[model samples]
Every structure is written in C-alpha cells, then in structure tokens.
Target: MFTRIASALLVAGLLATSAPAAHAQTTAAKKAAATKAAAAKTAAAKKAAATKAAAAKAAAAKTAAANAAAAKAAAATPVAPKPAPVPLTESLASAGIKDALNKGIVKAVQFASEPDGFNMNDDIHIPFPEDAILMKTTLSKFPGMNTLISTFETQLNRAAEAAAPKAKDIFLNALANISITDAISLVTSGSTDAATQFLRKNTEAQLITAFRPDISAAIDQVGAGKAYAKMTSQYNRIPLMTPVQTDLTAYTTQKAVDGLFILLANEESKIRKNPAARTTDILKQVFGR
Candidate 1:
C-alpha cells in the first residue's frame, strides 16, 4: 500500500510541471500569429498606394496627349480673306480729282519757291515784256546796256521766286471753292493738262486779283522797280526815242500764272502716266488705275 501511494505522488508532480510548460508554449504561439497578421496588413496598404500612383501617372499622360492634338488642329485651320476695294463712282472721281490737285499744287509751289526756280528754268523764264523788247533793243545801242538787261532779267526771276510762296494759300482756297460739275468728264478728258486748264479757266480772275499785290510787293523787295526805273530813265534820254509804258505788276502776274500752269500740267501728266509719281496714299488711290 505504501508503494502504491508513492507512485501516485510522483505522477502528480510530473503532470503539474508539464501543464505549466504547455500553457507557456500556447501564449508564445498566439504572439507569433498576431505579429504575422500585422505585417500582412502593412504590406497590403503599401500595394494599394502604389496602384493609385500608377493610375494618376497614366491619366496625366493621356491629358497631355489630348491637349497636344487640340493645339495641332487649331494651327491647321485657315483664315478669312480681306474685302475688295470700292467700285468706281462719280463721288470717287471727285474725291480723286481733289486729291490729285492738292498733291500737284503743293509740289508745284515747292518747286517754284526754291532758289533759281524760275531764273534757271529756260522753259518758263520771264523774258522782256512784249512792249519792252523794242525799248530793250533801242537801249542795247547805249554803253553798259547788256549788263542792265541782264540785271533786269535776274530781278524779274527773283521777284517771281519771292512771290511763288504766296500761291499756296491762294491755290488751296481755289481748290476749296472750285466746282467739279462733271468730274468724270475731267478724268476722261484724255488731256494731260485737262485739270490744270480747268483751274486756269475758272480761277484766272481770282488768281490775278490775289497775285498782283503779292507780286507788287515782291518786285519792290527784289529791287526790280529800281532796275525798271533806271532802264526807263535811260531809254527816255535816248534822242527821239518814244517813251514806252507797260504795267510791270500786270506783266509779272500774268507770266507767273503762265509758269505755274506749265508746271501744273507737267505734274498732272506724271500723275496720269507714271505709277511711281503717286507719292501719297490719296494720290495712289486716285491715280493708281
């Protein structure tokens, strides 16, 4: 009976030790499982973030391609054409005439007002007046008459050059006041001096009235009166020479007008025949055809 009791005690001791060890192993297994589960969850979140980033990169590339295509399409589109110029009309012709005249008048005045303008130009130089030619011929017999004649001629040209500046305002005023009843007729007149002739015909009286006082003043300023007085006094002193009288103011005025018309005619011809001579936009528009 004693042997049996000892054996039972030993077995109970062994069972108690094994029970504690088993409990320790179970706790260790649970801790390992939880650590593995946490690691798996972290890896899954990282993969999901990577997928989202790749999707965003692809979407950005697609948007960029779309924008490029749109830009290229816009660049290939064509633009609209400009409108044509207006057709020929009477009002257009009138406008053309005014523009052409303004250009011609300004240029002609500029040419005539410069140094040696009338004096150097053989085409329009003022010679001795018709009545004064006989007097000049008679005076030539006297000593130093050639020098006096030359001085007189030079004074006449200087007077014209001085008076040319006055024509600007006068011509502009005439341009403003002159009538163009049949502008087409003037345009189609086929004559180079058609416009210039029109101006002379209508504005001659006005020009004479305006130019006389200016010419008179210029004559006095250029010492032409002194020269004329010397010539007349000397001529009158000649034995039995008839005293010749001529209106210097009227003569100068008429000659100046004649010279201006010649210049105007030449200018108008250039505008009509030569495309390059139309220097201004209005001139080009009017005379381009």
Candidate 2:
C-alpha cells in the first residue's frame, strides 16, 4: 500500500511539471504573434507614406511642365503695328484742308502738257539760278558754261518727262483724298496749299529715291558731270555775273513736288464744281452732299 501511494504521488508531480511547460509554450506563441502584427503595421504605414510622397512628386513635376509650356507659348506671340491704318478715302480726305487745294492741282496738270512743263517751266525747270543764266545765255558767249547749265536742265526735264506715266497714280490718289464736304468748301477757299503740303510731307522722301536713278541716267545721257566741270571753269573766268550753283536734282525734286500738288488741287476743284465728275457712289455721296 505504501509503494502504491508513493508511485501515485510521483505521477501527480510529473503531470504538474508538464502543465507549466505547456503554459510557457503558449506564452511564447502569443509573444511571437504580437511582434509579427507590430511589424506588419509598421510596414503598412511605411508603404502609405511612400505612396503619398510619390503622388506629391508626380503632381509637382506635372505642374512644372505645364508652367514651362505656358511660358514657351507666351514667348511665341508677335508685337502689334505702330500707327493704326485709316481708311484709304479717309486718309485722302484728311490730306486737304477745306476746298482750297483744287485750282493748284488743275493748273499744275495743265502746265505738264505745255512745252515748259518739263522743258521751259522756270519754277519747275532748273539748271542754275538766274544770276548764272548768262552761262547758258549762248554757247558762243560762255561755251563751257552753256554745256554745264544745259546738262543740268536737260537731265531735269528727262527725269520729269520720264516720270509722267506715274502721274495717273498721283491723280487717282489725290482724288481719293478729297471728300465731298471738302470739295464744296474748296470752291470758296480757292487755294491748293494743303495739297502741296501733303505731297511735300508724304511723298518727298520716297520720290527722292525714285528720281535718283532717272537723274543719274539723265546725267549720263547728257554728260552733265563733265558739263558741270566745264561750266565751273568758264564761270571762274567770267567776273561780270556772280554765278550761283545749285543741285539740279534738288531743284527738280522741289519743282516736281510743287507741280504734283498744283495738279491735285486743280482736279479736286473740277470734281467739286462738276457733279458729273464724281463718278463713283462714294465720291458722289461725299461730294454731292
């Protein structure tokens, strides 16, 4: 009986020791699970942060590209024009003051048809001043001076006559400038100074270039340069007249401008006086009024 009781007690002791070992195993398993869960949570947080950072970088890059594109597009635009373009008719009408420019233009045009238009018109024709007229007075009197003065005048006429065809355009341009209101007033005003002013202001510079070649060609044709040297040499010998020297090209240019205005004014006046002359609806509408 004593042996049996001792054996039973040993068995109970073994069982109690086994229960503590099982409890230790369960605690270790729970600790491992907790650690794994914590690690997973930390990884998830890191992933979320990375995704947010990446999204921000992409948006910033897109914005920068868009700004760059906008700047490039803006740089590609052009600058605007200086003076605003007015209507052709309006600009012409504005050129004349009242009705004063009519007779001046008509007289100038008529003068163009005459012998002196380019050849004999003193105001329009140029060689040397009147004081130097003796130089061209006669070839026998001042042989060298005649050639010099003649060369200049001849070149001027050649240029003027050569430029005649261009007058059609000039006339048309002048017509457009005259408004009907301006025409009516012009009858009373009777002066073409405004037209002259316009030609001098607007056309002088451009015409200078246009006439250069013509003048040069004329000079070549007449041997004006050689003629000029001869005339100067002759003039130095003559003590009687103080010969005045002037540029024929400059003289012709000034005369041409004056003549153009005179012709424009004349045409303007005729149109104003004659209702039949205002052929177009626009012309009639403005002038007939």
Candidate 3:
C-alpha cells in the first residue's frame, strides 16, 4: 500500500510542471503578434506623411516657375517715341520778289513807330491817287506843313508797333480754322497763297479787339496822343486845308493787317519754290511738289 501512494504523488507533480511550461509559451506568442501589428501601423503613417510632403513641394515649384515667366514677359515689351510738328521753311525760301514788297510793308509799319518814323519817311508815305495828290501838292507848297503832317504820321505809327504782338496772338488764334485738308493742299500744291487766303477769311474780328487796347495804351504812353492833339489843333487853325477827324489808330491797324497778310502770301510762295528748305522728312514728302 505505501508504494502505490508514492507513485501517484510523483505523477501529479510532473503533470503540474508540464502544464506551466505550455502556458508560458502561449503567452510569449501573443506578445509577439501585438508588437508586429504596432510596427505595421507606424510604417503606414510615415509613408503617408512622405507622400503629402512631396505633393506640397511639387505645387510650390510650379507656382514659382509661373511667376518667373510673368515677370520676364513684362520686362520684354518696348515703349514708343513722340511725333513732330509741321514745318514752313520750304515756302519761305521759294518766295519771289513779291516777298520784298511784303518786307517793305513790315518796314513801313516799323518805321511808323520810331520818333521820326512816318514824319521824315517821305519814300513810303508818298501820294498815290490824284485826289490824294492834290492834298500832297497843297501840303508840299508850305515848307512847315510837311513837318506838321510828318509829326502826326509819326505819332500814328508809334501806336502801331506796340500793337503788333497783340496782333500776332490774334493771328495764332485764328490759324486753328485752317483745316487739315487745306493745309495738305497748300503744301502739296506748292501754293504760297493758301495761308493768305485762310488769314483773310478768319482773322478780322480777332484783330479788331486785339489792336484796340494795345494801340490805345501805346498812343497814351508814347506821348503820341499829346503830339497828335497839338498837331491837329494847329492844322485846324490852317486857312486852306480841310479839317480831318480820322481815328489814326484804326487807320494804322488796317495798314498793319494788310502788311501781315502780304508777308503770309510771300512766305507761302517761298515754301512752294524751295524743296530743300523743307527741314523735316514729312515736309519734304508733302511739299516736294
């Protein structure tokens, strides 16, 4: 009986030790599976982050390249230069002896402004028509009458030169009405008369207003009014001479306008005759006729 009991106890002890060893191996296998799952998840996250970073870098590079191309295109375009004005040198050079008459007219007006401009200037102020000749003949017989007549003429002319710049302004203002077609025809046809025609048609009203004030101021300031009053008072006291009540300002202004038109006509003729005088390429092309 004692031997049987001892064998059963040994068998129980061996079974218990074998069971613990089997449980330890199962635990170790479960731990290893959990670790492998965690490692796979980490790898997936890193791959996704790298793909996102590459996509962002590609997008930034494309944007930078587009901006550089826009900047280059802006820098490549060129700017244009400004154009020139119409020239009149050709017409001036081509003008004939008619131009001398125009120059003479200008000299006449200039002379009228000086101290003895009209008074002593017998050459320009000589008699014209037979009716006026009688008056001249009558004045000529009296030695001191010529001196008195010349003083009045000089005062009248002094008023005229002071009014010239104002007249220039009026001419400039009226010049705008000269049509593009008219200008083109004038230059291409080689006609000096075109500008004169234009001036005659446009400048009357403007010249009247411009000449009045300037003439008035010049006459008052230049001692012309006093000289004219004195001369006229003496003339009225003459026995045979007719008493004249003329506005010298208006007469001088009319003469000035006539002189200006004559100059314009002559200048136009000169431009027509001389092609080399056309300074600009456009002028040469247009006025070559």
TM-score of each: 0.67, 0.44, 0.50
Best by TM-score: 1
- Scored by lDDT, model 2 comes in at 0.59
Tens-digit lDDT string for candidate 3 (5-123): 99999999999989989999999999999999899999999999999999999999999999999888877866456545445544432332223223333443344445544334443
Candidate achieving higher TM-score, 1 or 3: 1
Q: Which ten residues in a row have the lowest lDDT in candidate 1?
A: 176-185
lDDT, candidate 2, 66-182, per-residue tens:
999999988897756665433435433444332333334445555664555767755556445454465566434743544446556675565565554454445445555565565
- In angstroms, give how far residue 253 of model 1 lies from its true place: 1.1
Whole-model Cα lDDT per candidate?
Answer: 0.83, 0.59, 0.58
The model with the greatest lDDT is 1
List the candidate 2 regions with Cα displacement exceeding 4 Å. 1-117, 120-128, 137-155, 163-196, 223-226, 239-244
State the lDDT at 85 in candidate 1: 58
lDDT of 2 at 15: 100
TM-score: the better of candidates 1 and 2: 1
Off by over 4 Å in 1: 1-86, 178-180
**Clashing residue pairs in candidate 3 (N, C-alpha, C atoms within 3 angstroms):** 90-271, 91-270, 91-271, 92-271, 94-270, 95-270, 119-150, 192-268, 192-269
